[model samples]
Target: MANSSQKKIAHENTKILLALRKGFIWVNAFYIFYRIIYQWNTFELKLALGYLVSAGISILLYTQINTMGKPRYNSKGELADAGEDLTQEGLVQYAFDIIYVTWFVHVTSAFWPKMWWFYLSIPLYAGWKVWQLVVKPMLSRSGAGAASDAASESTEGTKSRRREKMENRAEKGPQVRYR
Candidate 1:
């Protein structure tokens, strides 16, 4: 029974994880594409293309490493046996945040004084999303005099509460036996 519930939750996480991955990839791709087009009139075509190429290659490499190689899981789940994999994934995102913000700040501050806030948006938005996902757990683990129960952001798909409907179906695959 317990195993069934776990498998259901894993499946749910898989769906949300896939959707979030797709959204992030698309957002970054659009940013790179827009930057190249936006700079075409001012910067030399080669310079713009160079930026586009670099961003494109980085995205490709990220996808390859994340999908083809073993995936590093997030802290939200019991998916990784020892939690090491989850921590490594967080570290990778932290490094990415540093690299992205530094690069954006450097270039935007010098070339496009009109859009400095854009440089900050990438890092700030990422940080906000991380806070949503991790802040509760971090607080709970800190353990001061007043205790707060940890709450994780549950994606709509996560089936943590297995209904009696599911329990019966698990024993016999969904052919409904009403007593």
Candidate 2:
């Protein structure tokens, strides 16, 4: 009976977390569309730079907020708990918020509508998401694998070197390389 009740609690929590994540994601997606449509221009490069700055700030703040709740969210998230799943969704919201705010700043103050390639925003945002969330993690894992391989190779080299020294000592001679 106790186990059943605990499971129910966990399940309910997971559902809530999932819902929060979905809601945050929806907000992010909406903002992406809003920014692109509202600020269509040819000078997308400049716009992208501005967006990047805002994104940087937003990401920093977002990380700080999430980390502040690390004890609760990180562990729960790993266990597939509800509040934990919101972490990613929150990150997405943070990123889109950056872009939206930057767009707002540009349009209201420094924006020139004729300069941006607003059409590119859709693809750019999609690519950024893939690169940041998926591709980068994959690449980082690959890098770690490479590092492990290098470490293994160096360890083998050390073992072989020690064996060579022992063999040379056993043979009554200086090391000789025979072709």
Candidate 3:
């Protein structure tokens, strides 16, 4: 059926994306280690500071994403099913991915200084994520709280029939009959 074929395609896409993500992570780790271990004496202060800033941003964003309770990767290191959802968490992860790729480019640019422009994107993307994830939510909550207070005032005197029935049932407790 069409449903099964769709699922197969989705699984294949997941596998490909997961492999690419893992590959990038490993490559970045290896490059960073190589630079730090072998080229420490040649490293510029700017490059070291860039690495520290990137690492700090990465850790903070990762913790924020993790606390949202969505499992992005499974125990086998594959993408979790919910990872494909087009929800807020997914959007945040996508933004993180952008910063990640930019950070990689910034790292590589240590030798080719011409690519230094990529480093600018790291802070820009992070600022966008902060606006989307933090500031916007706080603004929305304040507006929603005022609206909810007004709505509660308007509905203060009435209980839905279903609520009334539920209350009555609670008052009666449990009933048992034997035949």
Candidate 4:
């Protein structure tokens, strides 16, 4: 019963994530079209190329998140484990959201310099994401072995009551009883 409840929760969460993903894609598409149709005269070659590249990236990420969020099934038709957590993909989508907003502000700031500050957030957020998703994992992987060994050593000195009881039972051996 608990398992079914958990599955229900997971299913709901997936639906929400998928809805957000679709919304992001639609907004991005709208922005791209808006720029092309409304601001075509202001476009530089470099900015146009960048938009194309960004569009391609958005398509790739959308497919990747879809693949990751899909649940697998066994041959017996039972639901197997869902693929990678959607929350992580949602974070990636959020990063793209920031980038899109920054890009819009950047383009608009050509007419009004005061909005220039908003674009600064792009590098700051990107750097933070890099630190979190890439640098932290690499650092942890390099130190994980030693860290785990030290953790095990520390934990060994403090057994839980359950562990102590199990050890005591093992040391006592089985007792024979008369009927």
Predictions in order: lDDT: 0.51, 0.54, 0.64, 0.66
lDDT string, candidate 2, 21-100, tens digits: 56446544554455556545543676656556654664565555444332232444533322333334565555545545
lDDT of 4 by residue, 74-106 (tens): 799766766655555566567457546655654
115-149 in candidate 3: lDDT tens per residue? 65676765697799899999999999999999989
Ranking by lDDT, best first? 4, 3, 2, 1
TM-score of 3: 0.42
The C-alpha local distance difference test score for the whole of candidate 4 amounts to: 0.66
Off by over 4 Å in 2: 1-27, 37-43, 73-179
Steric clash count of candidate 4: 0
Best by TM-score: 4
Q: Each model's number of backbone clashes?
A: 0, 7, 0, 0
lDDT measured at residue 171 in model 3 versus the true structure, 0 to 100:
100
Give the poorly placed runs of model 1, Cα more than 4 Å off.
1-29, 68-179
- Residue 155 miss distance in model 4 (angstroms): 30
The TM-scores, one per candidate, come to: 0.32, 0.28, 0.42, 0.48
Instruction: Give residue 151's error in model 4 in angstroms.
Output: 26
Q: Point out the higher-scoring one by lDDT: 1 or 2.
A: 2
